[model samples]
Target chain A: MINAPSPTQSPSTTVPGRLETRGASRSAATLAFAWRTALRIKYVPEQLVDVVAVPLVFTVMFTYLLGGALAGSPSSYLHSLLPGTLVMTLVLLTTFTGTGLRSDLSSGVHDRFQSLPVWRPAPLVGALVGDLGRYLLASSIVFGLGLAMGFRPDGGVGGALAALGLVLVFAHALSWVWIVVGISVRNVSAVNAINIGVQLPLTMASNVFVDPATMPGWLRPIIENNPISFVVTATRGLMHGEAQLSEVLWVLAIAGALLVVFVPLSLYKYRTHRS
Target chain B: MTHPVIHSQGLKKRYGNHKALDGLNLEVPSGGVYALLGPNGAGKTTAVRVLSTLVPPDGGAAHVLGYDLVRDAHTVRSKIALTGQYASVDIDLTGQENLVLIGRLLGLGRAGARRRATEVLERFSLTDAAARQVRTYSGGMRRRLDLAASLIKPPQLLFLDEPTTGLDPRSRIELWTLVRQLVSDGTSVLLTTQYLDEADQLADRIGVLNSGRMVADGTADELKASVGGGSLQVRLLDHEQRDTAAQLLGSQLKAQPHLPPDPAVVEIPVIGSEAANDALTQLHHAGIDIISFSLGQPTLDEVFLSLTGHPTATEELA
Candidate 1:
């Protein structure tokens, strides 16, 4: 539909310079529109609830149950055990994105937003970015629960904080993959079934619950190099007074590599769907 | 003259092999209501979606408010608001909150958005129920809130796709009044509906679409007249005299006998009211008695039946 805007209809000048003019080549109006959409997530507290409680449950359950089973004593296991449980909790919480995305699409909110003036990428980016607070909250509670169970990091405050940061980045990276699955499958039940199928094999196969060395030699390398296992091992090492520069790089590398593949694939699917 | 507010050339949309909109072309002039009338599966909604910038056309060119549909889609969206068949209000938010949220999303400041929301709520007669959650609202209130959300920024063009679809009779009349009020204020409106009465009540011009094509486009009177202006009918007294009267009236007044199955009497139909009066004099001169007589305009339902081979109930909308 193209007709030139009437001379008297220049509403752009009505916005103040600070809101209308911006650093990015894109119009500031576009940016503020995206920000408003993101801020609307404040009313959606249900999405954040799962993120908060899952980590606390996992940390407490594992510290008491798996800790006594794997290590000689529950307290002794807390030293080496709390780090892996935290990583597992982060991965478990990524399913929220898959379920949330599917619910939004099926409930017709996605179609409703399609008619709005907001950018196509705005909703997708907002949902992912909004979960950043959830990820942070989950990570903090797991660490706090671990500390309450008498688990102390051998690394200083900076090293422990860096290790927690690594887990968060990895979780955020994997979230893109879940976002793709959510958009593709587009059903909450289907997402839950598929995620459980993948998660069971991946978590049990990694070093989240036990030492990779305890496994047979052939399977050891896969577990040692399993990205989840690598993050878990590095985090455990850092918390117990053993820190290494190479381990940090490995965790960051896994996050960066997943970002390289899944983010573009998800965006490509998103752009194509037209929903 | 200024370009039409909406213009489309060869608009085509396909969902897999099923063609939702097959080469639809429409031009709506600025101001007044333009109604898209079609039975279900006629691609009316698809056409609205393409024009409103909600769905991309597979092949075509459209311009809305001087903005190209494809390349200048963002500009087109900024100038237009679409309220689809279903009420898209968020059940979790209050009616006022939904309108205010949409205003802010359109880049209105907090104070301005709230003020606009209040104004639109009052304009739509929803001021009393503004604080209630949308889920608690009646069907009519929810639909009114949906329309108010679309009007927060005073969009130059509005797309109302079946705005009266599920409303009860009273609610439908209320919405019809609101639609008239909006068009009178210089806002151009494009409305799509299967209900002929809605179009008759609200549209300045009507376009009838069937099987993904516009079969006829004209003012309501023009379309009605195209199918024959009016009808005249007369009933007779006795079943025994039905055949006798049919032959006499057919020869005397040149009207068809549309007799219904009944033991008592018969009826005849003619194209004009004068024909009935002519039949009365002719029948009396021929020693026949008349029971009743009537003159009336052809309804849109009759117009639809004349144009399409079948009725609309079996057909579905896109």
Candidate 2:
């Protein structure tokens, strides 16, 4: 049973009814929530498995299994395989954010957040910002594994860093789409199902693992025009120091369009749905 | 006159043909606990949500803390906190971290937030488990933390929706004590509960909600008295003697004697001590052996039954 605060240990100065006025600006609070989300990974260390161990395993397995037939050697295959794996790994991790948001809704945390005096979209935006850490960790592991396995980037350190920045921006923008799905879906499983359903098709039909020209004629258009293809090709070009402006612009345009459509859509759905 | 902390008129909300709240009105004064007692689906939670500015009512106006609910929702939100039916603290965060996060969101600086979190943790006796994630805390501990979080910047009014619904006896008593402490410090609380005894224990005034309407509202004694003066419960030694004793008591009291599911007991409504005495003498003269007899004021359940034509869902479940 709870007891009254003893006079000797009373901390009346910080009690309720004393403090007035909002404490932090909307953006600052959003950032604070983002920081809190990232901090949760510290307690649930298993969250790192998707970003760290999965990337290492995928890179090693793919490089060893297909490298001999496709690129003549494992080390040679990593030049192309690493960037594709990075895109696949980062994209897959975004589903976790959607599922996380769905669970937050189910568990009533979303209601608590909505009732607070903070910015309405802070929770959603903060979640996206927090997820950037996972994307960064996964990218670094893929790149580092490639380097350790005798893969080198001709685009030098600056080019490699730029490619990373582009991938992070793209992943961040793509998360808004998932956030919209998260808000609209009925359950966490549905969110995961929809996200995986959309992501696998986008990734496989793109020029990630194999050359678009080698694919059958009917499948060539999808492989050539796919947005993931644009991102992957841009990343490869940047990391190889032979960057293409058209492909980079295409990736940027797709990211901008996704943000423009989904951010407001998510906020609108969040406002309308009491649950 | 000073405005009440919460005032609503003709509050109406509907969910696709189901009227959660219909033409309801409420007035809650400052600095005391006002309990809204009702069964499930009686619109208690809906009323709380509307007053707290979480759900907008379709056809009513409300002022919470003197701010119009619709026009100045941000102001209302800043002045009120709601601890809902479910524990709303983040399960992934430690108890201390949950408080700190809410504090920072409420506009406190990092250091100020940490200091406030520490104070709340200590006040709620959660300092020992402050570093553990909320998922690991027991139900009582989680509920205490939920209440503590609502007090991070205590508002003038607090809304607790079924705050002790699933707690054990000891935890329920502890929460009742904490609510009393909060009320003593001048926070007006509007609570909803199905526990009749809970309302009897904590509320300065109680409102009985039935099917989207305020069926009755008064202090516990007043509401109980409204049902009738009192009730006399008679337990006969022989189960076979129940019908004759009930017949004699019913005619003497000029009221129906209620036969409960138990075969050995009969309950009679009495207007006063004189009525009870007349019935007792009548039973003795009829050679009815009474093992035990007691006269008591009507309970809230009886009041609810008289008003709503059915026992409260909690009583039925019990």
Candidate 3:
């Protein structure tokens, strides 16, 4: 069948000026990249695994291991654990942005993108948006599981929802750093190795497992100041209805600072790199 | 002369210590096909990439469709489309979806994008496979889909980098026919290829690139002229006649004459069709009875060999 222009359609606009044409094409490229990235999520949904498993493991482990030690009872500890799982899920799911970007680069997909008339920001923005779906899917599961485990946020519904929102922004902001890693490096396995290898030190150095004040001198400085520790701690505080504006600001500050630094670097490398 | 659609002056690209495009210059008119023929690593793909705004050149200036190479990249990109050596379609998407996505990306409305997608698919004879995932489609099918995607916006300039590299002979011919028809409709195409016959059949002008430089370029006839124009081959009924013919033609034609092992054949090289005709007239006047006489034009392969002093390498379609 010969598919022709629809009856309702008039002539396509041919805008004057070279700059206008370029801008229009770039916009089109951005939309195409976004659609392609979104469709890819359907086939390879590895982010789901990270989002669900990480939060579930952390929730179960923390409630069982530290519940009696910290809260005097597993039931009491469970009441305040929902916020930690929610934040952790978002963080875990967001890290896949790097992995996915690296995979695309290694698999000839990036080369394909390079050949197009795409805007410089399209791939970066598309990848970020695509990973947002992962964050949402995983965060909701953590929330549902938290509810099933008897963990109720002392914060009202608005506070609880606001906490979720904070996690999403934090995750997206952190995604920029990994996008740099993905774009610069060609090996996905190396990305995974580096990410997984560094994560333990980072997690242990934070306030995830124990109270920061209880640590020794040198370790206490690093652990207390760690970003993830602040996120988890602030989230825990938010769930208890004790909103810490300072801590939330700290998370936002870190996210914003990373975006300021890494986004430009990624774009610069993207524009200059030889294919 | 009318202003060329593409003009390059001493374009150069380097990879660390290695130069990929070395002091290259080219000019193509507003329409028809211009094929860049080269061996492996000769920089055909690099040239295309640089012109398409996908790869930056280390030196030299190029104006593509009247837009500056570096300053007017966005403008150049808007007017041009590239179908790379490999199909650039998203394999996860269906064939139709890939084209529609490109159409929409090119600023078509949702309904318009869908219509354009269907139009291109039907044009490429891909309507039957429109709904199938590209990953499941055959290589030739994906190649056609990729070409269709590039044409969705009806770009004035198209860069087809080795368009039929991995295709079956039949599919290759089909694509060639389509490409020819596109050129006929006023689209200018720059096709880079290693397939000599592909250049011979498709290009209005063929530029033979070697070692990051254009060693020779012109219409197919001009390329052939570089290798002594044309020749005449005769096969006699006996070996003595072949020897006598070679001897007679050698002194008269001012050209090389050779006798094969079969001994019944003789070949005479000439500068052009006129010289070939002159040789035939001289041979008949000399009472040399020839069983057969055939004129031969040098192939692109021979022209490449003559220009580069080596066998033509494949175009490294990176």
Candidate 4:
């Protein structure tokens, strides 16, 4: 899938050169890494499978299976379900950041990167940026499928796009926590195990599936305080046109807290990682 | 004289209880290959890792390319590259993509990166495999691509940790030639290898490492001369008396004897500072009978054996 632009021919084989270019700027380095992460999609098509299937399966399942009992009907329930499912989809996708980072940390490529003349945090940040494309794919799938299933939104396309942007931000912030996990874990399998372990409770226990009012009394407060709840509630509000200020602030606050806490923690763990 | 490419003082690193580097000091002058010759587990890789800024040292410090190792690490990183033992290119990426990625990181524009990648592929004879994922490449192919990635923009200094390990004879020869060309182009290299001939052929100077520290350092001829004369291989008729004979030769001759898995044979390196005949006489006086003894020639092995008291790891290099 890769094509070298205007491939050149060397007349004679010689040694490696006096450098033809200067050192890359930090942004350029990060962008290069992001380009690398994006390129991997070509080789590992299975990643694209998850990107498409998860939102498709969950949207169909939640609307048809649980929607009748919970929200009365499939079309009626999807209005609430579509936004929540998008939140869950993006949130779950965030875990993969850790999975990839864990393997990259163990691989010898990490050594090569560590010894490179680029910005140190470029690889991690660039991977997240590249992953933003996957989030965009998932968002578009949910919206497209939601519209196909006759789930209309009062807030219109701009609102849905705004919600898409919001969830992408949340995904990036949440990914930092996993970055720490990725750096701390001994192996890629451990990252996957923890991802699965945490994903179930984090996505399911939140208001993504059902309203907290329908949940048990003790679980209501627990769900209300969930960070994912803030994200889901804000996403739902943005998609429905009336963006609740409190929910939006809460979402921003939670994302801010995750970044504030985990960004440095992950970078520190990365710097001190015993590779 | 210009500053050395690398200068370190008492660099120390530990892995739990294992001291990977214990007060290791090194100096590599600019513009030539300086070989760190050691057996496996001799801390060669660890030393390279620390010097390349891939790992923070437990204690001590260094100046790589005249930049402070810890304080000015970014500056050090800007001037050096490391090709580790493993073929470290991204296996998931095509060989061409790996080079382009590295080229971009080295500050080339997209078209510049692609052109450089093509040039590098041609130079490394990897044009055929450039479009294939690195994971599909053979070991030699991966190694060449890894080396190509490192050379996208030749840093001021290069750290090659056993760069030719596991390579075939032809590839090894090709790599040696490349290293010479790089050096002639003024890229100082810190190379670590267990092959005596590799060091002799490529190194401007060699450092013998044993147990996380340098035992001797010099040019190939100087290193061989440092061993004094050579090694004394003594065979005993009695296996039970081997320890006694070893102790006799070690103390009396002031040289440690290496037992090379043969229960009845001990090789005592004859350093120039110490006399072997006196030890042989002492062995005879102490009633430790030997079948025969002979002095080995002053090859690179003898030099290593004299300094570290052990031979380099045996490999069937073609």
- Against the unseen true structure, what C-alpha lDDT does each candidate score? 0.73, 0.83, 0.75, 0.83
Q: Report lDDT (Cα) of residue A2, candidate 2.
A: 29
lDDT of each residue in B128-232, candidate 2, tens digit only: 999999999988888999988888888778899999978988888888878887887778899999988999999999988888878888899999989878999
Taking every candidate in turn, the Cα RMSD to the unseen true structure, in Å, is 6.8, 3.2, 6.5, 5.5
lDDT of 4 by residue, A10-84 (tens): 212233454535467899989998899888866887876674576578779978998898889877789888898
- Cα deviation at A50, candidate 3, in Å, is 5.5
What DockQ does each candidate score versus the true complex, computed on alpha carbons?
0.16, 0.39, 0.18, 0.38
Q: Write the per-residue lDDT of candidate 3 for residues A7-69, one digit (tens) a residue.
A: 311122122222123322555566566667677767556646644676588778888888898
lDDT per residue (tens digit) for residues B1-318 in model 4: 999988989999999999999889998999899999998899999999899988889999889989988888877877788888888888999999999988888788788889988987886778999999999998777877887787777678988999888898887887786677677767888999999999999999999899999888899998877667677889998889999998888887677777867788998877543477778888898898999988865779777766787767753332
Candidate 3 stretches with Cα past 4 Å from truth are: A1-32, A50-82, A99-118, A199-205, A209-222, B229-296, B309-318
TM-score for each prediction?
A: 0.78, 0.90, 0.79, 0.84
Q: For residues A1-275, write the lDDT of model 1, one tens digit per residue.
A: 21124321111111222222111212333443344334444555655555446546655677688778878878887777677777877787777777767766664556555666766666566666656666666677777887778877777687677777778888889889888888898589898887678864686678877787888999999888777888888887766657577887888898899999999998888766634
What share of the reference contacts survives in each candidate?
Answer: 0.15, 0.46, 0.23, 0.60
Predicted model with the maximum DockQ:
2
Chain A alone, TM-score for each of the models? 0.78, 0.90, 0.83, 0.90
Q: How much DockQ does model 2 earn? A: 0.39
DockQ class, candidate 4: acceptable
